[model samples]
Every structure is written in structure tokens, then in C-alpha cells.
Target: MRKRIALLAACGLLAIGTAAVPANAAEPVFPLVGPSALELPLPVDGSGAREQRLSITLDHPATGAPFAGLFTVDLRKVAGVATVRDHASDSSHQCTEKDGELLCAYKGLPVSLELDVAAAKGAAKGATGEITVTGKVPGATVTPLTTKVSVGGPDLVMREMKLKKDLRPGESQPMPLVFANEGTQAAKGVVLELGTTRGMELVETYDNCRTRTAGDLTTVLCSVEGDFVPGAAYELAGDSPLHIKATAHAYDDVLRYGIYPAGDEPKAAASSGKARAGRKLGVSPAKSAPAAPGLRASDLNPGDNRREFAFHTENTADFTTSPVSLKGKAGDTLSTAFVFENKGPAWIHAANPADSLARTVVVVPEGAKVTGKPQECLAVDADGTKRAEQLGAPRYECALGNRVSENEKVVYPFDLLIEKVVEDAKGSVTVGDWGTSAPRPHAFDPNAGDNTAAVVINAKGGTGTGPSPSPSTSGSPSPTPSASVSASASASPTAKASTAGTGTTAQGGNLASTGSTVGPIAVGAAALVAAGGALYVAVRRRGVRG
Candidate 1:
């Protein structure tokens, strides 16, 4: 019994010792300490093109003799066109697994990974993929650290734009274009290029606080005068639209170049692998589409019992038609029809009967002629410009009365008799009329006219005489408001002018000497305007009319 008891005691002691000695499981293992995380650079505010880097500099969690060799790090996946290039040291050979961590003692093995990101111009802006870094332990499982690759901070931004479409040949309109920078850094250089449709020419270009007329063809290009700072907006007013081809190319002189840095050396161009081919990477501007055109004017004829007096006008809100084009040539006299629309605000005040009439002009080529009394509603200037009197003029007033409410607009339509004549003529239709009341700011772009309808005139075919000649009418025509004029009523001048017979006179009225009341000059001005319309109308008719 004593021997058995001694043997049992020895066996129990040996078992306890073995348990305390610990198996391989109790030994510290390399790379088993914790998961790895990443840090990324982003913008304080959201704007501009994004370019950023992914940073990795976290500490390892575990330490042990088994983690004595090198490890590998790589990106697991990438979407879109993003790519990793010039990778940091691929292997960590000199790493030491000591204490409770894995440490790379030399710079040859990168402690952090850096990469240059360049989103393609058409590339989507956002996180493109994930990166995984794995640390290997000679006798233990490989540990992986994962992070997301994100894009942030923009380089350039578009602020505002004034673009127009569907311009007629030889036509030009003005636009106000604006730009800005929303990045943390300054932009070095900027340039704007002029593009036109195939048949259109850039009539004029203006910038830098100046009135636009004709631009110097030689120096038509525009460039930024100074470096642009973040959050700064630049404006280029007086840019005009031209009638040209649809596939025409309009872009910056040089789309992109080098960027200025905040401090340190400027970042170099991205590697071939970093560049993407089809990504949209920047903010664009918003714009409005073009308005539809007017109907043809000279198509009015008295066919059978139905009388069709067709007249067209461009860029006007409303119009009224008369049988004038068919008057003398019509075999039968029937009622005419008119079509029109009111484009501006519903509120506008006008006293003239024609103010409610929609007017239209049938452009007569310089040589065309008509037979019957040109439509009674049609008014002509000394030079030959045709004005439709039946169609009331558009009223654009600030306030219904003297108060500033909403901007106002009104459209007028008219009807006229169709006249027939025989003569070679060409012309375009003028749709809108100048109001008797003071002129207001034009609501739409000048070149983006409402509609231009082409017309043909013939005495035998039922067309009105081209247009009437200047009237011997009296009283000053309403004046067109200027840019200098203020929209507010308080800004209106308190002066008044009344004309007595031909002699000059000055009285208590605050009417300052405006200028001469040369009636013929005004008539000539209207005629010249009519002639321009005639030319455009003839061009379109070549395809639609015989």
C-alpha cells in the first residue's frame, strides 16, 4: 500500500509540471494581434475634380518568434478604370516580430503605401475599390489589413453658363458665362475657345466689362488674366451664340495642364496605368434649350371657298393675320385665321387696340412684288422693313402701374387680306412689334429668337405687296429702355417731353433735350430691319417652296 501511494504522488506531480510547461498553442504568434485599417484624404467641402491618396501607417498587434520573415501587400480588387502603379517595397524581409508587434526596421520595406490617383475626365467620382495588405508569419496564418480607396477634393468647377441652340445663318446672340474654382489650391492658367456651326460665323465676342460689337478676329481667344483662388467665381459676359453645325467643337484651348501646389513640389502627371480613358470626373453647367421658329408668311391664298392667309413671324409672343397677302389676287373673299401665344408674364397694360393684336410679317426678298393694297394691317418703313400693324405690340413692364411687381409680357395676333402680284422678291418675317410704352429689358437671348417663318410673294399667286412704305404719322415712337435704365420705378427719370408744332421750345417740363425728331431716319431704320428679314426668309423657302 505504501509503494502504490508513492507512485501515485509521483505521477500526479509529473502531470502538473507538464501542464505548466505550456504547449505550442500558448506561445505568442506573429500577425494575430489585430486587423489593419486605412486613412484617406478628402475635401472640407464638396466641389471640383478629385485627386487623393490612401495612407496606411497602423501598428501591428502580435509579436512572436514565428514572425521572423517577410510579408507581401497588394490591392485585392479595383472597379472602373482605376489602377495601382509604382507600388511601395513589395516585400517586408527585414521585419522583426518582437514584444507584441511586427516591425519593419528599415525604410526599404514601406511602412505606408502611397499612390497617385487621376480620375478620367469622364470618370465617375467616388470610391473605386478596396486594398488588402497581408503580413506573413513563417509558421502562422497570414494577417490581412483592408481599406477602401476613395476619391476626394476637386480641382476645377463650372459656375454658370449661357448657351443657345438652333441659330439661323448670319445670326448671333449674346450670352453670359461664368466659372469658378472650388478646390483648396489655386488654378494657374485658363483659356476659352470659340466654336461655330458649319454655316455660322462668330459675329462678335465680348468680355471684361465692355459693350460688345464686333470682335477682333485675330485675338478672339479669351484667357484668364490672373490665377484663380478657391471659392472664387469668374464671369465672362457678352459671349454670343452663332448659327453653325451641330457637331461643332467648342472647348478650352488646352483642356488640362499642370496644377499649382499648396507648398511642396507640384504633383507629377499620373502614370500611364493611373489614367482612365472614358470617365466623367468634373461638374458641368446647366443650360436652356432653343425656342421653336415662326410659321411661313406668304403661303396665304384664296383656294376654292376657303381663304388661307398664312404669314409668319419670329421671336414674338403672339400674332394676328389679315387677308392683305390675298386681297387683290383672291378670286373669292373669305375670312382669314390667325394663330398666336403670349410668352411673357400674364400681367401687362396697353391702351392701343393693336396692343392686343398678334402681328406677323411676310419677308419679301429684295426683288419680290405684290398686287392688292399690301395688307392694311401691314406697315412699312421708308427703307422697306415691314411691320405688322394688326398684331398688337408686346408689353414688357415692371409693374402694372408705377409699382414693381413682376416682369410683364403680352402677345398680340392679327389677320390680313391676301394680295397677289408678280415680281421677284425675297424676305423674312418679323414677328414682334415695338411697344408705344417705354421699352423694357428683353427677356430672352437676342440670337435665340422665337421663330422665323419664310414666305414667298407673287401678284398672280395671291400674296400681299411686299410691305407698306413709311407712314406720315406724327408723335414720337416709344423708346427702347437701355442697360443703364434701372428696373425699379424709383430709378425712372421724372422728366416729361411734349412736342408742339415743328418749332423748338423749352418750358417748366423736366424734358431734357433728347435729340432731333427726324421722321425719315426712324422710317429708314425700320426699312433696314425689314430687309434683313427678307434675306433669311428666302433662304429657307428654297427647300420648302418652289
Candidate 2:
């Protein structure tokens, strides 16, 4: 019976001992997970210094054991001076075990440590400090991780610009620049300045730009429109290439909040706006085209309201060469051909007198002397009324055939006959004016009267036996021909054949009398008429529109 009783007691004692093992262990236990250590980073002497405080508390430091005594705290500086009071301290507290956990009987507030660093008035270099805690709970181990306090001033480093070269005139190109805060200090009041070249114009915000001129450099104030965080790069784009420089600044307190920490790498220069100056602006060049030629009419018949004789001009060395010359004994026939081109966007109608575009250039050929009444065509007034008349029986009436488009050419033939001339001691044949006469009614149209040529030949004659000059009026008998003339005394002119427009021939080829209006109805009617005419021609030719 005694032996069994002893065995039961031993079993009970073993269980109780196992339970109390952790409660009675001697170990220093922190009331919080982190220590109450104070750390002061490098301090300046005069100016205000930034302050940072870290509060660490552990809810349950004595998990299962009593906190004994002898806890140690350590302060260290990674780059700057780290000062502290009572970095290592210890306190003894009587603890008790309840349930399975060891609890402190008296829990006093943590020991207080005051820390202050000196600050200087002027700029100072950067630095950092660290604080760590090493302590123990009864029968257990505890080591708190280190906390850091960084210190420094504003760090200025330029970054890339987002502008490209080849900017065109009157066009705005966006420019972007990035900057970084690499120091322990947080940058504020950063200013970026841009300078203008000769042709550059700044975009105004309020009708004008706020500018400050500093000797050779002009600084324009531009706002930093966006925010940038510490250790983070900020980018901004502006109007275009006008040289710019960027710097960083801030209000006093920075390091305490751990801004732009040390060990931050400097951004590469390639990321800076300074590199963009090497890029150039771009533009496209201009090109030119060739020139056109010059030409004019050689001669025209005013009487028949006919087409003028045109002559293409060649390169002239001098202005003296005679374009036309005429010499005729009392009676003779003069024939000449006028070469012409259509030079037109619209087709010419030879049959339509109202549509005819003819100007007369009468030429008296060189060496040809003419004698007798020279005929003339009376020009109608602006009212389309005539005022003068022609002499004895009209001789030649002519109008050139229809002209083609500018791509085509046409030619007209002319003939004139000489009627009479009075013999003079000088042997000169005088061409008399036979068309213009007072007290006589004028002809209504250009073809009604004789239209004389502009040039008249009066000198003796040329060596070769060429065609003789024609008389202006060929109705009467001509003078007797002398041996010197060697040509017939009577003259005759014939007209040439032509093919142009054969429409309802309503007095055509007359610009002044056309009297046409450009009204919508007229245009529509003309279009319909043209369409019908085209359809009729197509049908007559047995052709289809497609």
C-alpha cells in the first residue's frame, strides 16, 4: 500500500513540475516587440534639425515566461553620428504564473530617453543612423530588428527630355523632362528655366509670360504643375526646344521623414534635357516648274468679219525685219497665206458670226507700191451701231475657217486686186483711203464694207518678179502698165474653203454682237441643246453612247 501511494504522488509531482518549468525560468522579457531605444542621426550646430520618432510596442512579450532583468539596446551609425542615452538598460520586476502564462506583478512605464542632434546654418553633407534592441524573457530569447533614421539635404540630378528634332515651323512639339531626388532630403520649390533662341516664341499663359532677364540669360518662371515623391522621378513636358535647365529645392524639414534616401543611384545623363540640344529641326524643301511661249497674229480681214491670219513668232535678233511688204503696178493680184493655231480650251465655230474670234492685221508687203482708193471697214460703236462707209464696190471679203482646240492649228488664204493709180513724176504708186467718207451712212456689219490691210507698200519695187500688190478697190479700170512693172494691170482675189461649225448660222464670230447672258436657264437650255445635238449626231452616225 505504501509503495503504490508513493508512485501516485510522484506522477502528480511530475505533471506540476512540467507545467511550472516555463513560469519559473529566469529571462528578461520586453513588454513590447520593439525596444524603447532612442537614436539621433548626424546633427548640425545652428539651423533647425529634422526630427524622426519610431514607437514600437509588443502586445504580448511575456508569452509563457516571466521577464527577469538585464535587457540591452544598441545604437549605431551607418554613415552619420548616432547618439543615445542609456542605450543599454535593465529593470527587475516580480512576476507570477497564471493558467499557463507568466505575468508581471507590477508593469511600470518604459524608461524614457531623450535624443537631440546639432544642426548647422549652412548646407551639410548627408548621413544615416540605426537603432537595435537585444533582450531576453525568462527561459526565452528576444532580438528586435534595427530601425533606421536617414539624414541629408536636397539632391539635384537632371533626367531625360522628351522632345524630338525636325520640328516644323508654326508647329508646337511637346517636351518632357524627368528629375530625381537622390538625397536624404525631400526636394521642394524646384525650378526649371528655359532660354529662347532668335526665332522661338514662348506660349503665354495669361496673355504674357512672366520673365526675368539676368544679363545674357533670360529666365522665365514656369510652375511645376504636378507633384513628385521622394526617391521618385517626376516628368514634365513643355512647348518645345527653347533651352532649359532644371534644379531641385525644398522647405526645411526633409530627412526626418526619410525622403530621397542615401544609396540612391544617380540618373544617367542620357535621361537629361541637356542631351536634346544635339538633335536638329526638320522641314521640306520647295520645287519649281517651266515657262510658256509667245505668239501673235500676222494679218486679219476686217471686212468679212473673218478669222485673222496668225503667225507663230521665232526668236528675233532685231526688231527691224519686215513681216510683210507689198508693191503693185496700177492693177495686180496679191496672194498670201496666214498660218494660225487654235490656242483654245473651247472649240472654234467658223460658221457662227457671233462666235467668230477674228482680229485683222493688214500688211503692205515690202517693195510693193500701191496706188488707188484704199478700202476700210467701219468699226461699230459700243451700241453695236456703225458710223462710216466704204468706197466704190467692195473687192475682197474674207473670214478664216474655224479654229481647233489649242492642240490644233488652222491656215487662211487671202487675195487682193489693184484697180487704179495716177501716174506721178516720182513713179510712186499711192494707196488712197477709199472706205472712210463723211455724209455717207456706215455699214451695219464688218462684212458689209471693205476692210483694208494695215500695212501698205509705196516704194518703187523689189528685184525678183513676185506677185504684184493688189488695189484696194477693183471696180474701175486700172492704169496702163509700164515695161518696168512686167505684170498684168488688172487684179482678182479668191476665197479659200474651210470646215468648222455648220450650226444654225446665226450671225456668228462677232464678240460685240453676241449679247449672251450666263443665267442658269440659259446654261440649262444650252446644255439640253448640246445633249440633243450630240444624240442626233450619234444616231445619224449609227453609234452608241456607251
Candidate 3:
């Protein structure tokens, strides 16, 4: 009976074990699971904080089964934690804080949990920290999710101080003071102060500021409301002397309370104790402390901001011409050169080099006709009309183009034909006159006497010798005496004596007009006179025989 009962019990145990093996084989296997990492935006100056919402979604290989696990928020590596709130309010889950961490437990195959966190105020700028969310599955291992946070703050810097106008005694000028906020945080309730040295004054300002005068020096204090944003510039209020200094001050609330003390409230009692100690020692009490603390006033820029300028008197230009004198005879071509020079502390159109500054005019001698002139000069009628026909002594107008440098000189050559007798006849050449159509005349000529040059011409013979001179001095001389007259009048005639006197005068005139500079025109004049000699002799011999 005992053997039979033991056999039945063994069979029953075997049957139960076989049934459990199949049941265990039917269970599903799951893969890995983890939460997503996050990066939060925080200010560098520790003046501002950022809030981030994080979600941890369980990922598994099994599709049908739900996640069953426990999770915890590990904040031991995070240095600045202001607050943390659980976002599992709508779910049937409980989250409790312990040892600066949050712990939660849930039963499901695939589950998602959320958390909202904020950075602490007064956190040190550039400080880096991390928070982690770790999870555990009943049957599988899971990876932890980590997020990084950084601290930031504000930085105030002075860029430059510039003078916008020329400095002169008794004149007001604009001096711009430029400043910029370089950091990521904003600066609030900033104050700017300007102090000047003796001989400097503050006349007017665009910003609302208080001014105080001590001797010739001045002080200005101005305030700015609200916050000065990062990467923004603050320009000067108005025009002031360049000899001045500026300073900026603000309260550093973030550094004093949030970062230093590791709390949201400042240590007023500690500061109050210092004030009390001062009062007890018979010293005056200190002023009320600011809300934030780090630096009270920013260090003044490292370089010199003052500027100095020199002044000089206005400039003037003096233009002058050299003296001119010449003598010529009828039918003789005479050429003379005139020189114009500028003696100046300033050049013509010095303020603007591209403009026309002056005009030069040369009046032809009445007894002489205009024949040749410099290429830059234009022959004009007495009325100043270009290319117009004139009976005698046409005028020429020349531009002083590009001759604007100080101490510069320009030479003008004039050519003329002596048509009539001129006894010490005088002509003139003037520059910077109102008669020109040029834009602006020279400012002024210090010495007007030298601006006009005198020209003298003498035509030894009369007009009866050749055709009437053209309105222009360039008219051609009468045709050369015919070859028949030249052979017949080759012998000496009594009329030759009168002709000899005329020849002597003509030679003298040629020398006076050209001063060692003989040209083709002078040679042509000599040939014409030789031809006239032949005609004169032939006529005189005929008269003698009659």
C-alpha cells in the first residue's frame, strides 16, 4: 500500500511541474528602456533662470505587455536647484521627495513620467550642472537620462568716447560716450556720471541729468529706468567738451543673495551689523544697501578718454603777375610771354580740389592784332565772346585749370601782328577778375597791384604798308612782291633811305617781342619785308624817270 501511494504522489508532482513549464514559456521577454535628455537655457550672470519639462518614456521589445517598474530623480550632481515639481498628477502614481531626490513606483509594461525643474537665482555664471532620471524594470535593466544646465550673468563695458566736432575756444562741441552690455543678462537701474576738468563746460544735454559747476569744471549725473538689455549700446546725452570722464553703477542682486549666500534672500543682518559697528565708533551710518551685490560701480575704462585739439587762423591766397613790355612794327609778328604766380597759405579750391577757382584775362594791345596764344587760352572778342571777329586787339580768356597748388606758376604766350604805329601803347593782363564765367573767383588777392601786368607795343611804320589788319591778329601779310619787280628794283633808289629807317625799327621791334626766342612767324615777317623793298624801289625809280 505505501509503495502504491508514493508512486501516485510522484506522478501528481510531475504533472504539476510540466504544467508550470509551459506557463512560464508563454511569458513575453522585454528589451531596454530609458528617458530622454534635456538642455535648458540659463543666463550667464545668474540673474535669470529657466524652466524645463522632462518626460521619461519606457521603451521595450515586447508590444503587448505594460511596464512594471520603479524610478527616481537623482539631483546630487546639480549645484543650483531652485524647485522641482512632479507632473504625474493625472496618473495613479505617487512621487515623494527624499534626500534631495524624487522617488516613484508604477506597474505597467510601457509607462511615461514627467518632471518640471527651475534653476536657482544667484547661480554663479558659467557653472555647469546635471540632473538624472533613473528607472528599473522588474525583468530587465534600464538606462538613466541626464540633462545639463549652465549659469550666466551680465557684463557691462565701456566701448569708446569720441569727439564729433572741431574744438575751438568759446565754441560748444558734441562728445559722445558709448557703452555696451556684453553679457547675456540685463542690467537694471543703471546710473551714469560724467566729471570734467577745469576750462571744460557742460552747456546743454539731451538726457535728463543734474549738473553742478565748480570753477570751470562741471559734473553731470543721469539715471536710466528699467533694464539695459544685453548687446545694447548707450550713447551720450548731448554735446560737451572732450576733457571728461564717465562711470556707470548698478545693483547686483543676483550675486549678493542667490549665488553668495545660496538663498533667495540677501543677508541683511550681516550688513546691518557692519553699519551698527560703524555708528558705535562715532562714524556716520552707511547708506541703505542695494538689493543685489557684486560690484557697486564698474571700473572706468582702462584708457584715457580726454581729447585736445589745436586751432589756426583762416587761409588766404595771393596771386600776382610779372611785368610785361614789348615793341613791334607794322606787318611784324611779335610774340611775348607773361608769367602768373600764386603766393598762398592756402591753395585755390583747397577745400575742394575738383572745382574751378580763377580765370585769367589778357587784353591784346590795340595797335597789335591777335595771331597766336597758348593752347589753353581762347581768343575772344572784346565782349568776351569766343571766336568772334574783332577789328583789333582781341581778348583771350584762359582757365587756371588744376593750377591750384600754392606757389604754383603758369606761363602764357601771346602772339600778335603789329598793324599800326603804337607809341608806348600799353595793355594789361589780369587774373581772378569778375569778368570770367568760371564758378568762383579766388578768395582775394593780398596785393592787387601785381595781379595786372603792363604790355607796351610800338609799331614803327604806318598802316599804308599792307592790307588792313583783320579783326584777328592772325590775318595773312600781303603777297610777296612779284619776281619782275624784285629784279627791276634791285638797284638802289632814293626811296631806299626811307625804307632803311623802317627796316631798322622793324628789327628792334622783333628783338623786343621775342627776347632770343625766334620762331617761324618772325622769319616769315622778314621775308615779306624784303619783298616789299623790291616793290618800293621799282615805284621810286618810275617816279624819278617820269
**How high a TM-score does candidate 2 get?**
0.20
User: Candidate 1 — number of clashing residue pairs?
Assistant: 79
For 54-150, candidate 2 gives per-residue lDDT tens digits of 3333323324543343334454343234333321222333433333222332233332222233222232343445655433444443434454444
- Candidate 1: C-alpha lDDT: 0.28
Best by lDDT: 3
Task: Tell me model 3's lDDT, rounded to 2 decimals.
Answer: 0.43
Error of 3 at 19 (Å): 74
Q: Write the per-residue lDDT of candidate 1 for residues 146-222, one digit (tens) a residue.
A: 54444322244433333454432234444344455444334444434332212233344334211111211111223
* lDDT to native, each model: 0.28, 0.27, 0.43
Error of 3 at 451 (Å): 1.3
Say which prediction, candidate 1 or candidate 3, comes out ahead on TM-score: 3
Order the candidate numbers by lDDT, best to worst.
3, 1, 2
Better of 2 and 3 by lDDT: 3
RMSD of each: 29.9, 39.9, 31.6
**What lDDT does candidate 1 reach at residue 538?**
9
lDDT of 3 by residue, 340-438 (tens): 556653344322435445666778777777655545466677776777433243677666553244444444545566778668666777777444442
TM-scores, each model vs. reference: 0.21, 0.20, 0.30
List residue ranges in candidate 3 displaced over 4 A.
Answer: 1-313, 350-355, 388-393, 433-441, 459-546
